[model samples]
Target: MPRYDFRCRECGSTFEVSRTMNAASDPARCPDGHDDTVKLLSTVAVGGRGAAPASGGGCCGGGCCGG
Candidate 1:
């Protein structure tokens, strides 16, 4: 089961929901009778501290003595 984000135009409400793929395929309409409701493109990311650090260069903090 994957959570999805939906945007409601009738009430301008953007909310998240956890449901099955079937339910996710067919999203429910806005309770306020707004047909403009649509699924928003989003990705579920995990920002955690841990694992291995980057061996390459990144922004200001990269290789030795970046000026």
Candidate 2:
């Protein structure tokens, strides 16, 4: 299950809910029992090492300068 963030416009409180992707658009009630809420756009964090830089004899390292 994925967690989604929602903000309650009635009480001005933020909350989270865990549900399936199919019901991601479903309305969520805040902890304060506020039904008027809107889902917030969340950011995903990716973890992993970046790709190694290209190696070559050129200004851009990829032989762009005809090295």
Candidate 3:
């Protein structure tokens, strides 16, 4: 399962949910009980991009050291 972040337009609430990739695009209900929620764009720390690379890294992963 993968985690997804979502924001509710009706109540301006933010939340996270764990679901299968296939269902990742499905509409999510906000924790505040709002159904008008949209998926939030998340930042993935790919190797060699985003933040500074680890001391022994091949890509920049904040500190994940994926490289």
Better of 1 and 3 by TM-score: 3
Show pairs that collide, candidate 3. Answer: 48-59, 48-60
lDDT digits (tens) for residues 1-67 of candidate 1? 7888888977998877788987886866766767678899886676568656656667556666666
Top lDDT prediction, candidate number? 2
How many clashes does each candidate structure show, in the order listed? 0, 0, 2
lDDT of each: 0.76, 0.88, 0.84
Off by over 4 Å in 3: 48-67
Candidate 3 C-alpha error for residue 33, in Å: 1.2
Clashing pairs in 1: none
State the lDDT at 44 in candidate 1.
63
Please identify which of the two predictions, 2 or 3, would achieve the higher TM-score against the true structure.
2
lDDT of 3 by residue, 4-64 (tens): 9999999898899999999999999888788999999998856655666447535553465
In terms of TM-score, the best-performing candidate is 2
Candidate 3, which ten residues in sequence have the lowest lDDT sum? 53-62
